[model samples]
Target: MCAHITDSVLYRHLWGTDETHALLDDGPRVQRWLDILAALAAAQAEVGLMPDDAARAIADHADVALLDLDDVAAETRACGHSTLGLIRCLRRVLPEPAREWVYYGATVQDLTDTWTALVLRDVGALVARELADIEQAARTLAQQHRDTVMPGRTHGQPGLPITFGFKAAVWAAELGRHRARLTEGRRRWEVAQLGGALGTMEFWGDAALPLLDAFARRVGLAAPDVPWLTARDGVAEFVNLLALITATLGKIGQEVYALQRPEIGELAEPVTTGQVGSITMPHKRNPELSEHLVTLARLVRSDASVAVEAMVVEHERDGRAWKTEWAIVPEVCLYSHTALRLAHTLLDGLRADPDRMRANVDAHGGYLVSEPVMRALAARIGKHAAHEVIYEASLAGRERGVDLRTALLADSRVTAHLKADDIDRCLDPEAALGAARSFVDRVAGEA
Candidate 1:
């Protein structure tokens, strides 16, 4: 009966993690809302805006276990208001004196937005931890394959040699940037929201600012400079960062997908025993984890767009804009977490065929080292002229079905300055890996 794939018993594992689901699900969500209300009451009491005993009573009875969710839903549907149903249901459990003091001077935005900030704070920490783990895994790969040579392709054609370590280092560096971003942006997005009715907090009078700070302290978040009733840039920024992180994961997935091809065979995703790639094809090891990373990234990207769209709102409070976040934020969080999890698994168990990569390069008849040859010839003739010579030689060699060394040896233009030894040096894959190994070391050190 689950309407969305995120909630579906069968498909939920692919779309979200249990940790995120716990944070966003109705049971925990409602409980957090109650906790927030309790914190508000306690803050009001601290500011002398409400009675002390009422705050105590409210805090003591803030448990969500006491409320019937079906009744809450029924009342919500009947009243056509967002938080009133929960407020009324909460009052039923409170004593007479504390009932009125429960949600004093607060609005739906105050409750929901503060809850969102708390969610961001927790989710941000989770993401940072996951990213750190992923970066370490990538750094390990970079160190392990510091000299493992592979064909560095451009536009789907082999261009020159590059170490697999260099590729993994690139991933590690990008992930490190995301970790930095999360650290820098946490304060901006994890501040409390406490705007009442039209964001003025006029109902709370002179005590409003103090109460805001107290409420934030109770909830373990920072007090915002002002209530973000209309400014949704923080939410948008958080989701967009998630988009960027997932996109990087998707890029890694795409690389695995392309390199795992039978013709290429330079890399492969981990396959467990008895895992079936296809129902009909008996000989297939599909890239399910890698492909799913792409899928999760695309969905998270879509959710990020919705978060961005929710930034454009009307006046002090727009239900159209902020309400969209009620759905978009949680979805983005779930999808992003799932991507990070899968990416960690993929990187941890990844298989790299150094021999296959070298063979593929050799199969191209040393053409993958064309860049080094072009550069050596460029020293003799100007760069453009060397490009012309190499271009012509490459074409003729392909037509004649001979190695680049044979084709270049037959051409007077190449043999005039460069002998067989020079060509052999240029064709050396290690020699062609200019700065690749060093870059891996640099990135690994940074990581």
Candidate 2:
């Protein structure tokens, strides 16, 4: 059964995405643990810790479907331990000779953390692909609307003229930073975990380090120089990185949601058939997808906090903190996955209402071009003095319900610099979008 959003089934559509569910679900996770055990067995054999034939047999038969998950769960609760249940289940499938060597000297952190590395490797790839989609989408929009003039708002008020391309470029830049984050952060995260009891390989002796390297190579992860049994900074850092990624996506989502308001009408999400926004309000086209991006970010951030807070663990192995990770890590990965995927789709189909953008700029009556006008007049008057003059005029204009240009025209101080035509030209919103296309070209070309 799918997860529910709320008490009302009508709004349950935004509960979760299929991709997120798959990434965090029980069956896939169990399968991953089995795969890790198989790799460990093969690597152990190479290091002369186990027989080659036994290792091969263990690798050949470590199938999740072959074991009963219900039994695994039951044993897990009955034993009150992490890998014991899974180990016992796998033992049932192995011959007596192989059963002793199935897991060998590995610990729970070794299995679970390595599995986390595997998931991180895959999750990073998925996030990169989706972020690229969003980046390309924003690029296309930036290029398409290179000259589409709109008001650049500050403090939720129209402040200056800027092109739609410039706005998209800013978003693209932020997403570019996210891409850089994932690229650099992956190396630090996708490291193997194979430390025995108390961060020492005492149980396996001389064969421990070699076996760990072989296992990591077999599993496509880098062998860490030291064990991270109690040192969870890497896990916390990785989760925090995901939190930053989700926050960036949330920023994009919030912008779209705010711009999609009917009164603003600057942008709208792509409307799909059979997708109802509201039942009570017939005339509704809510930014549901973008809003959910924000929601997913919040959930991922909460999970990240748990992971970070868990970093202050007791010596060697703290079940209190490590067990928290068992719950939080997957949760963060799941929602962060959803956020990235949804952000890609939403950005790909985003509709930039250039006409409405222009209309809004025009409706603001030259108020948005105050910065350019002020800058132009700064050459005539001192910068601070000119700012004061323009500030007063702007406030008066708003109070009297007159255009900013009109107020400036009546001001003797501003009139001393130039004529009415110069003011009009300076106030043109499209004329003030400085080097937006150049920036778009630079970033897009690099991408």
TM-score per candidate, chains pooled: 0.99, 0.94
- For model 1, state the Cα shift of residue 327 in Å: 1.0
- On a 0 to 100 scale, what is the lDDT of residue 169 in model 1? 94
Model 2: per-residue lDDT, tens digit, 201-221? 888889988988999999999
Number of the top-ranking candidate, with TM-score as the measure = 1
Model 1, TM vs. native: 0.99
Scored by Cα lDDT, where does model 1 land? 0.93
Tell me the tens digit of each residue's lDDT in model 1 across 1-447. Answer: 989899999999999999999999999999999999999999999999999999999999999899999999999999999989998999999999998898898999999999999999999988999999999999999999999999888898888889999999999999999999999999899989998998888999999899989999999999999889999999999999999999999999999999999989989888888999899998978899999999999998998999999999998889999999999899999999999999999999999999998898788998888888989999999889999999999999999999999999988999998989999999898898999999998999883
Go through the candidates in order and give each one's C-alpha lDDT: 0.93, 0.83
Residue 432 of candidate 2: its Cα lDDT? Answer: 80
